[model samples]
Target: MNIIKFSAQFPVEKSCIEHFKAQRDACGVVCPKWGCVHPYWLQNKLCYECKQCHHRQSLRSGTVLENSKLPFMYWYAAMHLLTSTKKSYSAAELQRQLGHKRYQPIWEMVCKLRDVMGKRYNLYQLTDEVELDNAFIATLIAEEEKDKPLKRGIGSQRQPKAVVVNESSFVENPKPGKKPKRVNHLKMLVIEDLRADTISKTVNEHVNPKAELTTNDATPYSKLFEQVKSHHAQAIKKEDLPKTLPWVNIAIGNVKRLLLDVHHQLTNEYLQYYLNEFCYKFNRRYFGDA
Candidate 1:
């Protein structure tokens, strides 16, 4: 929903809390101690009481909001802004929008949301035709690497490596000046290295075993054939990348632009969180205002 609709729906903190409670009820509240699905709502305490074991849990228990002291309105507003836009907001921008005096809490809240988004996407694996590629994004050096001499080029301390995977299929009866391949889901995973073992393990975990894979003949993807049903590795010329692996390259370029545009100085530690937010929004691009 847009800002107006969201404001109308949740005008006050109590409204947000009530809506959150309703959503949690729809998802079902399980007792943490006994693993019981049925729990009695303790209206006075704003918690759930186990029907059998008498265990009690707060509304935010077991959720990303657990241990967070921020108001429910803050989280609801953050989620709305994050999901409702094509790009993202930095923690400072979000803090200003919320009119909050603190920055770290808002930053942590956004990071936790992004973390859960990555975890949610992990539940599904890319299937059918898939494209794979590696991306090098500019990231701040780690604290421990401060003393080490920085290398130049792609291996520089400022650049971090990530694996980009896109689920795509051939588009039949394509329109003029349109992409030959259509994309479905996308994933960008931060990794330590681009070794063959690392690439193979990542593909094995995130992609279906029977999926058809396509990528440039990079040594890191040498063992991809063992992970998927078919690995069509080729030496892709610079211009041929669009035809060989269209969606993966496009995804990489778009994400790079996103980071460059909004988040200027990203750190290696939280690069994955930023990537998670990008992929989450891209995957749900069709779901308008949902």
Candidate 2:
């Protein structure tokens, strides 16, 4: 939603709390300890009481906001800004906007949200035709490597290997200036190495076994056929990437630019969280301001 709509909908902290409570209620609160789906809302305590074990859990007990002391409005506002924009706000920028005094809490909150984004996307597998490729995203050198001699060129800095896959469906009818395929869902996974087994494992987990796959004739993708029904691996030139593996290439380029533009220095530990936010927004691009 737009700023005006958001402001009108959640003008006060109570409104945000009520909306969150309604959403939690619709989803049904489960007792994390006992896995009890039914829970009674204790008005006085503002928590859910499990009838089965007489356990009381706060509203945010099992959610991303479990230990967060931030106001409900802050979270609602953050969600709105993150979803409503084409790009994302850095934790520092978000903290400035939220008027928060400390940086750690806001950063943690953003990272937690991004982590959940990855988890939510993990529930679904990509189907039909997909293009797979690997990207080396620049990252901050490890503590041990910080004092070591730097290598030349790309190797001078630490770059994390990421497996990028996107579902692309062929469009029978050609629109003027449009590509032959349209992208659906996309996934990016950071891996230790770009070995055949590593790439294969990522594909098997995220892509449906029945889906047809396409990739450049990279040696690491040699065993991709074992994971999917069809594997089309061909040598692709730089100019022909638009026709060969359009969406995956575009996604890789866009994400790299996004990270470079927003968070200049990245750590290997949190690289996946950054990727998760990009993929989450890309997947929901059609749902503008939702």
Candidate 3:
């Protein structure tokens, strides 16, 4: 939605007390100990008290907007801006758009909201026809460069690896020297190790066992299919060009662009967070006017 529409739908200083009250009461029971239930007092401007423990839990508690000193209208406006845009915005840009004089607070606020959005992402389940792959993420370090010998064996290598596992979905493939058409579907992961154990653990945690799996003919992924109902393998030649699934390629391409264009430099320590943010946005790419 545009700013005008968003403003109309959620006017500035519109009291959220009733909204919070409704959300609180939706639980149907007041059990403060479990952190879900509360009693709404209309006379107190919809202030709620925990029924079980009688503890006071504000409406923003357990929500993304919690602990924010910013006004509710600003928070709502920020959410609208972040969710409505396909292109990710830097904190500086957000600060400018919000017309906030202080950059640090707005930057921190955007990061926090991004964190909430990351946590709220609905990731794919490894149910059927999933793709598994890995990509390298290099960090720019300010040090003299030295030639490091390439290791021959995967088992002996020490380079950090990003293991991506995603579902198979159709995406539009654009032709060269023209606006790219979007097709194909896939998900991804950035991992520290490509070892069988590490990859297997991540898959087990994120993917459902009932789903079919696919990957390149890698030694580490050989036994992964055993744990699931079906596992398939495809081989790619080193000399051959990468024939990626359309949506997967687009997603990865966008991630590469973000790394180069937005962040510029990312370390292994925080690479996963960056990946999560990218994937969250990518998965929601089709949620128009959200």
Candidate 4:
């Protein structure tokens, strides 16, 4: 939805509260201690109390908003701003939009929400046709050296290589001079090493066992098809790609865009969190108005 419609529908504080209540109800409430059924109490107008344990729980008690001192309306506004746009905003930008003088609290809040979004979604499992590739991300190591020469290797480098695994599912219309359209479901993994074992383990963890894997004639992926039923290796130069594997190219393009646009630098320690966000957004790209 656009900003205008979003503002019109969720203008008041009460409306935000109602929206939260609806989401909370749909997700259900359980006794925090024993995980028992906790039915909503309409009279209370906040949350359900556990019948057996008698534990009182708020809708946001155990969620990402737990212990948040910010107003519920503000929280809703922040969520709306974050999810409403395809373009990403830095903490500074968010702070400006939020009209807050302090940066730390707002930054922390945005990071927390990003963390929640990271945890809430699952990656697409490639089952029929899959494309696999890897890319390196150049990240600044220090604040002082942010603008230092990167190509000359002057600044400390954090090479967090990412693996791109995509599935051909829903094909879009092909453009002129473009390869055949393939519906691609993509997942990116940030790992320590690109060893055969590491790649294999990552693939096994994310993709289903029945997936048909496709890759360049890399020795690491040569024996992978043996584990699954169908693994195809195309002997193409690194520069030249096969026409059938349009999904791989698209996935790579998306990764580059994300790195250059959304996240400027990613350290190995926090790479997974960023990848989680990317995967969540990619998976929900088609969930329009929902």
Which segments of candidate 2 are over 4 A away from where they belong? 32-38, 151-157
* For every candidate, C-alpha RMSD to the true structure in Å: 1.3, 1.8, 5.3, 4.0
Reference-based TM-score, model 3: 0.74
Q: Model 3: residues >4 Å from true position, as ranges?
A: 15-31, 34-38, 42-47, 51-53, 122-124, 139-160, 169-186, 238-246, 264-267
By lDDT, the best candidate is: 1
**Ranking 1 against 2 by lDDT, winner:** 1
Report the lDDT of model 4 for residue 242.
47
lDDT of 1 by residue, 93-177 (tens): 9999999998899999999999999999999999999999999998778899989999997688898999999899999988998
Between prediction 1 and prediction 3, which has the larger TM-score?
A: 1
What lDDT does the true structure give each of the candidates? 0.93, 0.90, 0.62, 0.70
Global local distance difference test of model 2:
0.90
- Taking all chains together, the TM-score of candidate 2 against the true structure is 0.94
TM-score of each: 0.96, 0.94, 0.74, 0.81
How many Å off is the CA of 232 in candidate 2?
0.7
Highest-scoring model, TM-score: 1
Over 74-113, each residue of candidate 4 has an lDDT whose tens digit, in order, gives 6777777777666566667777887878887776787788
Q: Model 4 clash tally? A: 1
